[model samples]
Target chain A: MNGPIIDITDLSKFYGKARGIEHINLEIGEGEIFGFIGPNGAGKSTTIRILMNMIFPTGGSARIMGMDVIRDTKKIKTQVGYIPSDASAYSSMDVHEFLSYCIRFYQIQNGEQRISDLSELFELDLNRQIADLSLGNRKKVSIVQSLLHNPKLLILDEPTTGLDPLMQSVFFDLLRSENKNGMTIFFSSHILSEVQMLCKRVAIIKEGKIIQLEDIDNMRKKQLKKVSVELADHVNIKSFSIHGIENVITGPGNMLSFMYSGNINDLVGFLSGKEIINLMIEEPSLDEIFLHYYRS
Target chain B: MNKNLFLKEIRRNSVSLMIWMIVITLLIVVTMSFYRTFLENQSKIVGMLSLIPKGALQFKGISNFNDLMSVLGFYAANNVIYMMVLGSIFSIVLSSNILLKEEYDKTAEYLLTRPVTRSEIFISKLAVLSINVFILNLVTALAGFICMELVMKTPFSIGAFLILSIYTLLLNILFGAIGLFLSTLIKRAKPITTFSIGLVLIFYFIYTLSKITEGAAKMGYLSPFRFASVDATNPAYTIDLWHLAYFIGISLFLTGLSYRLYKRKDIYT
Candidate 1:
C-alpha cells in the first residue's frame, strides 16, 4: 500500500472500569470503502470516537493521513467529514442557518455551491427548523453537513441508519461517487447487506476484536453452499458421498441435502450419476455469516 | 476562527441577551421611579436612612435629594451583581454547549473530525464569552445611568460610573470564567446550572456573613461579589486593587484549567 489513509495502532479506550475497546489495530487504504461491521456495543462507535479525537484513548494512538489524532486533530478534522451514528444539529436553528453556521466555522470559501449541491443530493429542506425535522430528515442534514466541505476522508458511523430505503440508496450512491473522487470512506454498520453491497472490503468485529478482514469477493469465494436433491425412490444416501463434502442430511424417499465446501465437482458428478428428480443449491445470506461469527 | 465563533456565540445567546436587556431596563426604570416618589417624601426618606447602621448611613452620604440619588445609585449598582451572576450563568451554559452540546447532540464526532484543534475551539469559545460579558455589563450600566438621569434630573460624575462599570465588567468576566470551568467539569446542563446557582448563592451568603461579623470580615475576600464597592465616598469603600487582581487571576486560572481538562477529556455517551 502507498500509505493508509487511516492508521490505528493498538488503540484502546476505557469507560471508567469498563472496557470500551482494546488493542484495535487497522490501516485503511486511500479511496477504499472499508466497512466496519459490528453489532451494537461491539466497540464500533468507541473506535470511531477515538479516531475523530472527540475522545482520548486509554492507551495507544490513531493517525489520519500520517498525522497524530491528538496532536494534529485540527489539521485532521479539516480533511475529514464525519456523520455520527445519531445525527443531530442544534434544534433551535433552521437547516439553512445551521449549515451556514457550520460553513462559517469550517471557513470554506465559495461555500454556497457546496451547500446547494449537498442539499440537493440529500434532498434536505433548508428552510425547516431542526427541531421540526424527523429523525430521517435530520440524518439527511447530517449527511449534507459532512459532505458540504468536500473532505478528503469521510468517517461515517451507521450513516444509513434512520434513512428510508430510497434515501439509503441515495446515500450509497453519494458515497460511491465520493469514493470514485478518491475520498477514503470509513464507516461502521451492523446491516451486513448494506456492507456487502457498498464495500469492496470489510472487517467484521465481535467482542471488540476484529474477527475477520477480507475483500468482499474473497469472502464470497470462501462461501459454503447447501445442495438438496430428491430421488425417484428411497435410496442409500451414503452411496452419494464424495470428496470435499462437509456433511449430508438424508431423509425418507431418497431426499438428500449436502453441505459442500470448496469446489463441488465430485458431489456434482455423483448427483449427475444418481436418478435425481429435483435439485436446489442455496448460497448462505449475509445474516448467516454474521450469525456464524457470533456463534463461533 | 475567533471572529466567526464569537459571532456564533452571540447568535446563540441572543435570546438570553434580549431577556436580560429588557428585564434590566425595566428594573432600573421601576427602581428609579420609586426612588423619585420617595424623594418627594424627603423627611420620610431621611428618617429611614437614619435607622440604617451608622457605617451604611455614612457610606451612602444621604443628606439631600442629590445625595439620595447617589445612594440610589449605590443600590442600583447591586443590579450589576444580578447581571454578573445571570451573565455568568448564561455564558457558562452557552460556552459549555460549544463542546459538551456537541456530545449531547451527537455532533462531536463530526466536529472533531474536522480540521480544528481542541485548543482553537476552546480559545474561540472563551473569547466569545468574554465579549458577551463586556457587552452585558456595558448595556446594564448604560441603562442604569439613563434611568438615573431621567428620575433624578441631576448632573452625576460620568468618570465614577465608568470606573464602576469597568469593575462590574471585570466581575462579570470572573463569574463567566467560573461558569465555563464548571461546565467543563460537569457533563449534564441541569445539574451544572443548579450547582452553579448554589455556588453563587453560597459565595454571596459567605460575603454577607463576613459583613455582619468583625472577626470574620476577612472571609469576604473569598466571595467573587465582594470586590464590587461603588460607595467610593468613604475611604473604607475604596476597592482593594490586590483583591481585584486576585479575582482576575482566579478567573484566568479557572479558564486555563477548563481548557486543559476539555482538551484531554474523553467524550462519552
Candidate 2:
C-alpha cells in the first residue's frame, strides 16, 4: 500500500542445472496494468508462479501487497486472484460446482450473485460439466472463477488463449473497468499487440531475463520511430550515415525504411536535401519495437 | 486442515471406495457361505488337504487343518487375500493418487492459488485418505463378523476376531502412509497408479515367498505384510506389541517425512 504493490528483488530460479529465471528485479506500483511479455519458455510463467507462491524461487525473493510471497502467501492470496494459462478444471464438476468451490475458498458475501453476474457476462452455462465444454468455454469458466472473489490484484498468464475475438473484447472491457476501480493487474502474455493495447507499462523478458522495461508512450513517442521513404532515382544508401538509424531495408523504386532513434531535427536535416519525392515517419508497431530490442 | 478440500476429496473418492467395500465384502460373504458345507465334509476335505504341500497350506495362512474347523479360522485363511492384500491395494491406490491427481488433472493451479497453506492442503487430503481407509476396513471387517455370526456352528473367540480386524486395518493404514510418502517424492506430474499397485503386489509376493521357504523366512521382515500377523487360529491370538510398534512407528515416520517433503516441494503443473 505504501510503496509498490508488487516488488521482486534479484529473484532467481533454476531447474537443476538449467535456468528458470536469473537475477530478475522488477517493481510494479499500485493500480497499474503491468505487462510481462515473453515467448515460450522465456520464464514469464516462472516469475508469475513465484509471485503466486506456486513454486519457490531458488534465490532472492518476491513480495506482493507489501508482504513476502512465501511467508505471507495465504494472507496475500486473500486479495490476489490468478487465471492460469491452462483452462483445465475438475472435469467431474459442472461449471457452477467448480466456481462455487473456488469462491468458497475466500470469505465473501454475495458469492452466488457474483458468479451469476460473471457467467452471464461471459455467456457461460453453469450446469454444463467442465469435461463437456469446449476449450473456449472452459476459459470463460476460468475467467469467471478468478473474478468471483473480487481480488484486489489479478494475475493472468496468457488468459486470452482460447477466447474468441468477441469474448476477448468483453474480457478487455471488464479488465479496463476493474483497473479503473483500483485493482492492480499483472498481465503476462507473448502477444505484443494485446499488451500494447491494455498496458501502460511493460517488461519484456527473453531467455530467463528482462530485456526491456518501459512505458508504452515513452517507448514509442520519446524514442523509436519507423521511417520509410521513396526517391525519384536510386542512390547508394550506404552513403547515408546518422546516429540511431537501424535495421535499414531497401525496396524497388528506391524505396527504403529503417528505425530512427536520433533527434527528428537531425533526421529531417539529413534527409532534407534528398528524398524530395516522398517521406513518411510514424510510430512503430509493438512488433517492430520488440524487434529493435531483440536485435539491439 | 482445509475443510472444503477435505469434503470435496471425500465426495470425489466416494464411488471408488464404495466399489472396493462391496467387492471385499462380497468375497467374505461367499467364502463364509462355504463354511457350513465344508464343516459337513470336514473329514473328506481334511484328507484332501493332507495331499497338498505344507508350504502351500501355509501360503493360504492355514498352518493346521484343525484351524479350519472353526469358522473364524476358515474365514481368516480364505479371506486374507481379499481383506489384507486387496484392502492394502485399495488404500495405497487412493493415497497415492489423492494428492497427485490435482497435478495430473491440471487442477492444481486452481487449488494452490487459493488462500490456503500447503500444510492445510496436505493435512486435509491426509484426513480424507485416513477416513476412507478406516471406513473400508470397518465395513469389510463388520461383514466378516456378520458372516461368521450367520455360519458359526459354535461361538468363536470375539477377542481373536477383533485382533484380526485390527491387524488388517493397521496393514491397510501402513500402505496408505507409504503411498503418501512416495507421492511427495515424485518430481513430475503423472499418474503412479500402476507403479503403486505393482509395489503392493511385489511386496505380497515377497511375503508369500518368505512364508513358504524356510531360508527366505528372514526376508519376510522386508515386507510390511510380514508384520501383520494373520495366525487367527493360534490359541494365544493377540496383537503383538512389537508388530503394533512396527505398524504405528513406520506409518508415523513416513507420514511426518512426507509432510516435510511436500511443504518444500516445488509444485509444477
Candidate 3:
C-alpha cells in the first residue's frame, strides 16, 4: 500500500512484428493525476489497455494496487474505472437501463444514488436510448458509468475528446474532486492545457516510446519561452544574444523574436537598455514542447 | 452468479420464444385436423397409414386417433425434428448477438473494464445462452404435449416425453455453442448470423444425403440433428448417450477455444 498504485515495468506489446509499446516503465501514486500525452498511434491507448487488462503485454508486467494485472485481472478491474476514447452503450437501452445493466456487474452499494448523481452532474437524459444521444452525450454516459462504481483507480483515454469547453471544465472538476479523495487517475490527452491544468506529472509519448516523463513544473521550466520585441527601427539582432537568447528572428527589420531558455532576469535587463516600442513574453505551447522533445 | 445472468438472457430472447411457441402450436393443430378428415375414409386411410414406415409413423408419435382429428392433431405436435431446428435457429439468433453487440455499440471497452475477468464474462454469456436453449426446448416440449392431448385425447408416457425433450435440449446446446464460437471469430453480426444459418442448412442436407446414399448414411453422424432420433419406431427416439456426450463435449471445447482466442486478440482499432 505504500508503493505506487500503478507500477508498469519494462512493459512492451507487439502487433505481429510491429511494436505497440516498447520498454515502457512508469509509476503513478495514489491521489495523483498522471497525464499521458501523445499524438495519434503513439501507444497511449495501448499502454492503458494493458493496464486495464483488456490485453496482455508481450513483455514485462504491470501491477495495480499490489496485484498483477494479468494474474488478478478480476480484482484489478473491479477497482479501476475506465473511460475509453470511443465509449458506446447498447443502442436498444436507454441511459438508465444501460447504467442499471453495468451496475449489476459490480459489487457497488447504492448504485441508484450514484447513477442519479452522475446523471445530474453530466446533465444526461435518462429516458433517451443510447442511439438517440449525440456523440458527446454518449461520452458523458460512459463517464457516468465509469464513475458510478466509485473505483479506486481511473484509466481514461482521451477523456475530454468530445466535450465542449464548459463540459470539459466540469469533467476536470470532477476528476480533481476524485483525486482529492485519494483516487489515482491516469489519463491520456492530446490537449496540453488540460494536462497542464489537471496533472502534476506527465509522460510524453512519441512513436510507441516514452520521450519524456517529468514533473509538469519541471517540464515548463526546461522548455523554452518565446519573447518578441517590436523594434522602432532596424538594428543589430546579435545584440539580443546579450540576454543568453538563441534562435532570434527579425522580420522586415522592425520586429525581433527569439527563444529564451535561460533566466528571465537576464532578458529583463538586456531589454531595459534597448529602444523597444513593445515587448511580449509567452511560454511555448505543449505541441512545441513535444515537438522539441520529439526532435531530440 | 450464473442463475441471475441466465434469467436476464431469457428475458432478452422472449421475443423468439413467443414466435417458436406460436409456430409449434399451429403445426399441431393443422396436422391433427388433416388427420381427422383422412380418418373419415376409414378403409382407405387405415390401409395407407399402415403401409407407411413404422419409424416414420412413430416419428410423428400419432397412433389410432380415438378422436381422429385429435390423433392427427398431435402428429405435428411431437415433430421434435422441427422443434430442434427451431431451437437451433433461435440459439444462433441469440448467441450471435453476444459479442458483436458489444463491439457494435462500442461498449466492449466499457464491459471489459468491469471487475469480471474476460473468461468470466465469456462464460456468463455462454451460460445465459445454454439456459435460454434449455428453457426454449422445455417450453416447446411441454406445449407440444399439451396440444397433442387437446387434439388426440391420447396420453403419452412421461418418461418417453422427457427423453425426447432432453435430446432436443442437447441439440440446442450444440447449435448454441456453434453460434457462440462464431461470434468470437467474426466482428460483425450479419456475417455471423448468415454463416450460422448456412451451417444449419449444410448439416440438414448432409443428414438427408446420408439417408439416400449407401455410404452416405454415416454422414448423418456428423450432424447434431442426426444424433436425436426423429423416427420414434426404432425405440431409439432417445438421444444416444455417446452422441449426447459428443455434443456436450464439442460445445464446451468450442466455447473454451473462443475464450482463449478473445483473451489475447488485439481489440482496439
The most accurate candidate by DockQ is 2
TM-score of each: 0.83, 0.93, 0.82
The fraction of reference interface contacts (C-alpha pairs within 8 A across chains A and B) present in each candidate is 0.83, 0.87, 0.72
Q: After superposition, how far is residue A34 of candidate 3 from its true place, in Å?
A: 0.6
Q: Write the per-residue lDDT of candidate 2 for residues A45-115, one digit (tens) a residue.
A: 99999998888999999999889999999999999989999999999999999999998898999999999
Task: Give the DockQ of candidate 2.
Answer: 0.76
Candidate with the larger DockQ of 1 and 2: 2
For residue A245, what is the lDDT in candidate 2?
90
Residue pairs clashing in model 1 are: A74-B115, A74-B116, A74-B117, A77-B113, A77-B114, A77-B115, A78-B114, A78-B115
DockQ, per-model, please?
0.51, 0.76, 0.47
Model 3, A9-42: lDDT tens digits are 9999988799899999999898889999988888
lDDT for each candidate structure = 0.74, 0.91, 0.75
| Residues B1-269, model 2: lDDT tens digits | 99889889999999999999999999999989999999999999999999987976876668799989898889888996569899999999998999889988989899999999999999999999999999999999999999999999989998988899999999999999999999999989899999989999999999888987989989989999888877888887789999999999999999999999989888888
- In angstroms, how far off is B133's CA in candidate 2? 0.1
Question: Of the pair 1 and 3, which is ahead by lDDT?
Answer: 3
B1-269, model 1: which lDDT tens digit per residue? 55665677668877777787678767766666676566578787667766766534332232333345563454433455565566556555555455566666665555566566778778877776676666767777788777767765456666566666666677767777777777788654233556666676787677666766666678977987667655533333444688678778988899889999988877654
TM-score of chain B of each: 0.83, 0.98, 0.78
Quote the positional error of residue A19 for candidate 2 in Å: 0.3
lDDT of candidate 3 at residue B256, scale 0 to 100 = 82
lDDT of 1 by residue, A196-254 (tens): 88889999887677778889887666556767889887777666556645557787677
Docking class of 3: acceptable
Better of 2 and 3 by lDDT: 2
